[model samples]
Target: MAKFKIDINANKHFTGELSPVFSVAEARKASQFHKGLQGYEPTPLRDLSSLAEMMGVKGILVKDESYRFGLNAFKMLGGVYAIARLLCEEFGWGIEQFDFDKLKNEVDEKMTFATTTDGNHGRGVAWAAEQLGQNAIVYMPKGAAEQRVKNIRSHGAECIVTDMNYDDTVRMVAEKAQQNDWKIVQDTAWEGYTDIPTWIMQGYSTMAVEAIEQIAEQGLPKPTHVVLQAGVGAMAAGVLGYLAEELGASDLKAIIVEPDQADCIYRSGSSEKGEMINVGGDMATIAVGLACGEPNPLSWDVLRNCSSHFVSVEDKVPALGMRVLGNPLAGDERIVSGESGAIGTGLLAAVHFSDNKAELMQSLNLNEDSVVLLLSTEGETDPVNYRDVVWQGKYSSI
Candidate 1:
């Protein structure tokens, strides 16, 4: 059996239905806002040229988001922006008129922000709330890492662990938030709740803005392809939306990847109707960040129209990616990518080394001239798990 499930999005095309929020112009505004934060720096976009040559691609650029806000992940970009936007709305102030310091000084009421997360997003929300002397309540699904819970609580948030899985916990948190009037900073959008998620997605577009700008500065050609990993499609959609608007969809071939266990976006894209798909149960997977089963309805629209292909791969794929990045080729910078962070690299490596590279390469439109872009969305958030994969070779297919 194939270790991968490659699905062509028959509905994929340039629909020109780009949301105003993801316009490159708007994303630049968000990036400017993030720059106004206390400690803001654009993460490094590494040129994995040697790896690209081995894979028979012209060039490969991986945006290492491990350095984002000292958080070891890119989740905070969304959390901080959504939280800031919430405060701006509540105070009747324009975002452009206030910097981080001004916003912090102006907050009179201590507001509570609530959200459900696996690990990264909760810590992000808690960090954002703590920065402005506000409160946060973070709900985590069952089997959430204790280290993750402690990380959130370290930021002064009340971290709650529940017996439910990620998606179920989201529903439960929504009920409690309604009862307590807590502002939900979730990335997944649903009926009657979209503005915060929209803000979060827009915040995520800063990555796209930075990556494209960095490519130009490095004298590299624009990326012909992007390999994005998705959970609820928030991060993937957010980045892809901005790229499509800025680069023009005609030139970029986008691919969305997810773990086989919880590939909601892949399933939805492959489905005939291309509607929202939900996967329920204990979403057991080593790539915990990509184990989400519910597709964000808002992001689903963008992926359906803006992306070229979707692939769901085994845990071994990400395992290989982690090892390759940790042990880089000569003259290339080493990256300590976590399980969720390294999958894009892993998927590319798999396609290169697979026995049927011809078929797989043709399917993905990857070749000697393809300029690929990958986002290493995190670093070693879970040291134990990272060691298990990289040191022990726990899921190495070989």
Candidate 2:
């Protein structure tokens, strides 16, 4: 197994300051927008008490995004909501006044939505475009699985496999969108491109809102710690923003997990404020969805303050988590988590099982009384890889 690395944020402080950009109220509004869409239902928040016991934690709650909008991933929430907001703005109609059917009928065929992704996010963009009756152009990074490219195309969007890494592909698409006048509905934000990505982050708050309500309905105490996996940190920011609102920042421990090879967030957290660091190279990780080389600028603000700890694990870590979730200890419900989805749980397992367990556990304040929450962000986005890892016990050679 590959060794894990942890970085305690130097500037980590729980200010209890509500984020103006992403708040519980904003998330609630985003959730309302999602409710108007077809196939809108809250995904399950599973109680993995047995797994908690195994890890010696008080409780372990997992919000499974496998069932989200039939896409087997959570990106649809962001993609669709951003598309809606973009349409509303373009048509000069308020969200409440905008009609989907009317927009679909009148939407200009020349208007196209475009984005870049490793897999799930591209499919989400394509799905959103199909729903809105708009054309979509999706670009995927080199070495992206064929199944993922096909999934994007299945949504009636034009899918292109590019000979570039994730970040480069994103830049390429952005430039092309600007040149061709296609609307860019990306989830990651840069300078002067914050508005739509902010909307995307707000949309992701729906998952957090649903999880909090589900926990309350089940009479479970609010999670003492939340472990979120990051690509560009959009989902992490949204979850942290909502949780910081509900459970004060000081009361909750927020951990950001990423692939060691693609540890941009970890590097960013360790750097000086406003300093951008790139975790360069191919970012070859089994968890393709979290293989981002850079942190989203907008998300960095929330993550830098709200996140207490950052952990970067090797590909073996999430592979182990996929196996553990797929074939849980007796009495534990099975969770079909894809490579990206299982990293949070994998990080927890690594800490508990490592030789430096005592020190690492103490650093994160993980104890028997700790209530941990995790978001399983995708489910078998690449089935061939999933089967090899889960059934054959093969570690990704990538």
TM-score against native, each model: 0.96, 0.95
In model 2, which regions exceed 4 Å deviation?
Answer: 1-16, 108-110, 272-274, 396-398
Query: What local distance difference test score does each model get?
Result: 0.88, 0.86
lDDT of 2 by residue, 1-398 (tens): 23555444533533556697788889898988888887789999989998899888899999999999899999989998888888888779887665778987776564699999999988998998888788899999999999999999999999999989999999999899989999998889887898899999998999999999999999997899999999899999987998888888878889888888898988887765636578878999999999899889888788877888877777878988898788887777888999999998887877767778877888888899999999999999899999999888887422
| TM-score, cand. 2 | 0.95
**Per-residue accuracy of model 1 over 98-127 as CA lDDT, tens digit each:** 566775676677889999999999999999
The deviation in Å at residue 80 for candidate 2 is: 0.4
User: Top model by lDDT, which number?
Assistant: 1
Q: The CA-based lDDT of model 2 is what? A: 0.86
